[model samples]
Target: MSKSEEASQRPDTPHYENATGGWGSLKGVSRILADQKPTFGAFRTLMRQNKPGGHMCTSCAWTKPAQPHLFEFCENGAKATIWDLTRERCTPDFFAEHSLTELRGLSDHELEKTGRLTHPMRYDATSDRYVETTWEEAFEGIGAKLKELDPGATVFYMSGKASLETAYLYALFARLYGHNNLPDSSNMCHETTSVGLKRVIGVSVGTCVLSDFDHCDLILFFGQNTGTNSPRFLHTLKAAKERGCKIVTFNPIRERGLVEFADPQNPAQMTVRPATRISDIYLQVRPGGDIAVLAGLCKRVLELDAERGSTILDRAFIAEHTTGLDELEARLREVSWEEIERESGLRRDELNEVAGIYATSKNVIGIYGMGLTQHVRGWLNLAMLVNLLLLRGNIGREGAGISPVRGHSNVQGQRTVGITEKPENVPNDKLRELFGFEPPQEEGRSTVDLVEGLLDGSVRGLVSMGGNLARAIPDRARAEGAWRGLELNVQIATKLNRSHLLPGRATWLLPCLVRAEEDMQATGPQAVTMEDSLSMIHGSLGRRQPASPHLRSEVAIVAGIAKATLPPNPRVKWDEWTGDYGLIRDLIEATYPDKFKDFNGRLFTPGGFHRGNAAREREWKTESGRAQFTAPEALTALGAPPEGQEITLITLRSNDQFNTTIYSFSDRLRGLSGPRDILLINPEEMERRGLSEGQVVTLECAVDDGAERVVRGLRVVPYDLPDACVAAYYPEANPLIPVSYRDELSKTPAYKGVPVRIRTDEAGA
Candidate 1:
């Protein structure tokens, strides 16, 4: 049998019965440490993560506490840190041994396991392998190629893996190159939050501070699996629960993180295995049902406000700080109970019960993740969520607001420092005045737009800072083919990924320093800043020695490219900024004086400085100068699927993975191990469809596009999920997601709620 077929036939292991983050978590960490043995200062590096005078964890964007615990890192964070600090090296000989064809056949986990990249390498077509080349040769060759094409023809993509200094330089470099085509990881994830919130609240970020969790009376979580994505957040939830704060969660899968948590930092809890109960209420919301559930809650809250003599609604606050209440109320009233029940998979009374909890609570905070944003109407979903929160005056309150937990530690920071497709999002006048360049006024291509341009032969090159674009993007089969025809493809990365294999005519793999490794520039060792999910900026100082002498910092890499590509601008000192990151911070402060004042001074101020939020301060930047309540045009978050026996497919991450990087083949939290190409379905649904356990299946996208988008050799596993709703690992299932299928306003691909038909694979038979 073929290797792919053999992988599809791997049997499901017994589910883990322990609570999230107990002995099981410690075991997971130990296992990773054992695999990547003799890590470079592993103990010292982990001790400093999320702590004062230390670098931030490269995992989730969770903020550190004022007084962090002895070990603030989580299981996955440890994996990420150790994964970077591994002794294994992918030297020139390693690449020469493995051909591109051989690398392409490996799984995501296997590809990343190859170890850290040691030197700059260029794709040698003659040998069909990557051969070592000096940094100067790679940079000069790429610079020459970029000079040949129009600035708009080449796309500059950034990932969340880099520091804020790198992101700032990347944005500046893109604009200096005469285009604003700065698409980052945000384009695929929380672009919906930024676009949606700005339209109503006048700000593109969350309004809550980390301290707000302490004072909140209630916290509502939607479509976020905090355990796997942001395990450190479990500490915040546990603390809130102990302080008499109620927690309610809505997700299709019963993620162990929200249900209960045993803090790894707490010796008593870890030893006893008596996990602290987390969610006061757990609602199994069906995929793409968040908007319907939110609409139902809004309607019920308004009704209760009337019945209770207007006491439930903050009438005075509404009159003073908001607009469009009457229209929102009318729209909410139009939504029928039957439609809400059918779409949300919940009864009216259940929604009313939750709404009642909201009405009684003086201060409530709503937290969400990609689940709310990776939908067709993702931007609208955020608007509707804001409407529900605004009814009780949650916008500018101390302990009541909206928090969109971002996946990458610095993804939010990248957008904040000016990586965006929309030209207007950045300060054009300030940039033109400071950098002496005419910033492009026309909107640039987003991730989705970039893919379309590639397919149409409009985009000729891709300069990605640090993301696996080939696998992270939708319709991988179609996009990867177009990538090969490009004139240039440059990837500045610390390790090899699937994207490096999709080599263009001029492909160069430039190695950079990881966050855990010291980045010594021309001046001396430097520190980089990272902004967390709550808008707090923390300084990251690497303690370990450099992995290789040839490695360059991301800031230096960007500066090298910029200096080589653009004509020498006297005002911009790329060489000096690359030598000292603090200088870059000074310039960033100069650009956004109000938001980043004293950037260097506040780099290590205990818990880091909070970048002030205008909406949180009640200073709305909207056209009306006040918060606006919006209602969805439709009750459903996603439109109806084409006629067939199709099920809603929600793409998710495994406990062993962080973003697109798969650390191991095991997902301990879900009781699954081995291969990620497994489809999770409810037992009753499996029985109803005459599907058996361990059955290999093929999923085809239910789209009208002539091209067939399908993934084969997926093992079926019965899971505890809502009927007609199945789940699959992201990027693996990403091929089934259409590039054109995205949010209208934000342009985020609908990774969640994808409609697909599953049939038994002929290979398994």
Candidate 2:
């Protein structure tokens, strides 16, 4: 059977009559009953579709190909795969039937109903429809419009899925055109972690590679759900557990995946029942209370060391490579136990137990995700993680370091290949040396700044490498409105998403090749590089046929735009860089020798290569040549919850969802299905407010700013969450987050920690 025919025949197919079925339907029923379900193993196999070679899901960068024939897939990964392999298609005729205005009125689900775009398209104002356009015309039109705008007014945004080669060329094109306004999905997620790490350590990437997980004696995971977010890491966790590693979890909500994960690799476990125990000590922390918890742990560790009268920390490593120790120690000493317990929602005894685990384990791994970075004090939280690692001299050692799990396949690689609004010291100097042109020294706009600029008409053009910017930004209404004002909006993507609907006066959607599809050049098939969450750089060669014959590689598309926009000033040859992605890798190597030594040569190897992180071996790279300590002051209580607010809402990702991409409406692991309109609340909190399961509640942001944003009539499902805290799906709840509510230094949106009020309307009173 053909791909489409086969997809329709699948048992897990979405039934339009039902509107919601498969795993999503199962989740909805589970939520109603307030119970967890064991659909992960089945969901894993269903997502992969029994494809030959048995590949791992590529939803997040963290997924690694499992051994021989293991069926391993996370809930979100399943959704991503299902979405990609859906039996949906949006042809030119479909566009002809609906005008942009008509499509705008359609729900997000209805718009996505048209299926995926199969060809390049352009918007025609006269017909009020999008018509299929040739690759040359699309490229030429984008180049012309971009040429008209001053480079300063143009912004280049990238998503996490973009390969390293494409990212490198995207950055080169912007630089060649004299603009540094390159914002990406990273800005929306892990920018705070990057900013904090760069200041504390010399590098902005994670210190540990995946191999480090195998050697860890103790794993401290904060604000991350491995089963749903990074299922591939479960194997490592399972291995570590079998070897007696203590895994401690700190998250507000009790994630099913983190609690118990089933391994599809073992036949006995699969045929009968095979599940791995994930967390030994699951600490239920209040939202934005991570800093306090970490500080308390560090303080207890210090106290323990003092009593033992022996060096618990790697003193030699700290003295040689870090600075600011005295200040960090003083801050930790000043924080009282009373304040720590109250703020972190953990008692002194609990802190001591956690510290005791760390004290006994010679090898520890600290893994963090958006939970630690999506708060008002996200940067401080990252700094605190670094401080905790430094306290025990975790860096530059076997099985010990800081690991920031990145969201996209090549998000970190993009940064390595020069995708940054602000140029780093090494990349800047190298760009100057390689291109023989003085790179811009001035800073450029971040994601938040880009939105603000677009709203005010300062940003005239937007070039998205990949991503649905309109749906991804904080305030949906404001962000979409800003895009409407743009003179030109160009989207280079493999699929059609909501961002494509937010047309500029002149808009172009250029079709590009996906990482899973082939990219043929004059030389041969080209390979693209991606950096994993562990800072390991590797190459991916797509074997499947191109989704469309007309589709071009991102590198070629970028080069075409550059050739059309820029005057013939060849500091670095543009035409010569199109076909072979290896040429781009060579440029990256020339620009960043320390990270990409013999980039092309090493990439050809089977397992690829690791970007050297000396700090992983106890070599600190901070000012003063010694590990510096950053003592966090006691968190001053934010005056009691807003007077009359029933519950505080915290935004989170459903198991079947990712960043802003909704693979399906169901959250099987959470027992939620059918729709994402439900809010997960603690049962006690709901009863205290005189609310019951399935009750509709209106969530309002109690912001100091005058902006009004509300999500109404959301169903409430009681779950195992802290009493004062309630959890709702993100992007849908993004409106509740105020633009001003961001981390002080990193400027990350405090999506994980927002103060809001819930109210129920009386029916037929």
lDDT of each: 0.87, 0.72
Show model 2 residue runs off by greater than 4 Å: 1-57, 63-82, 85-87, 107-110, 617-619, 636-647, 761-765
Candidate 2 lDDT by residue in tens digits, 1-765:
321122111222111221112333334334422322222332443433213233334578773532323444444555555454344567778888988888878656566545556778998888888898887788788888988898898899999888888888888788878878888888888998778886677567788866777799999998887756776677778888888998888888666656665565565655565456677878788777788888888888888888888567767766777777778778888888888877787678877888888988888889999888877778888888888888777876778888888888778778777888886533777777777777776677788888778867899999998777787777666567778788998988756677888888899888777665567986788878787787767676665555457778888888888887877766667777776678888888887888899998887443347787755655555564445567675452122344566355678776656677665566656556777877777767777888778788888777767777777868877776776778888777877776667777767777877778776765201
Query: What value does the lDDT take at residue 345 in candidate 1?
Result: 85
lDDT of 1 by residue, 582-638 (tens): 999998898889889999998888888998999999888998998998867887677
Model 2 / residue 697 / CA error / Å: 2.1
TM-score of each: 0.97, 0.89
Worst 10 residues of 1 by lDDT: 2-11
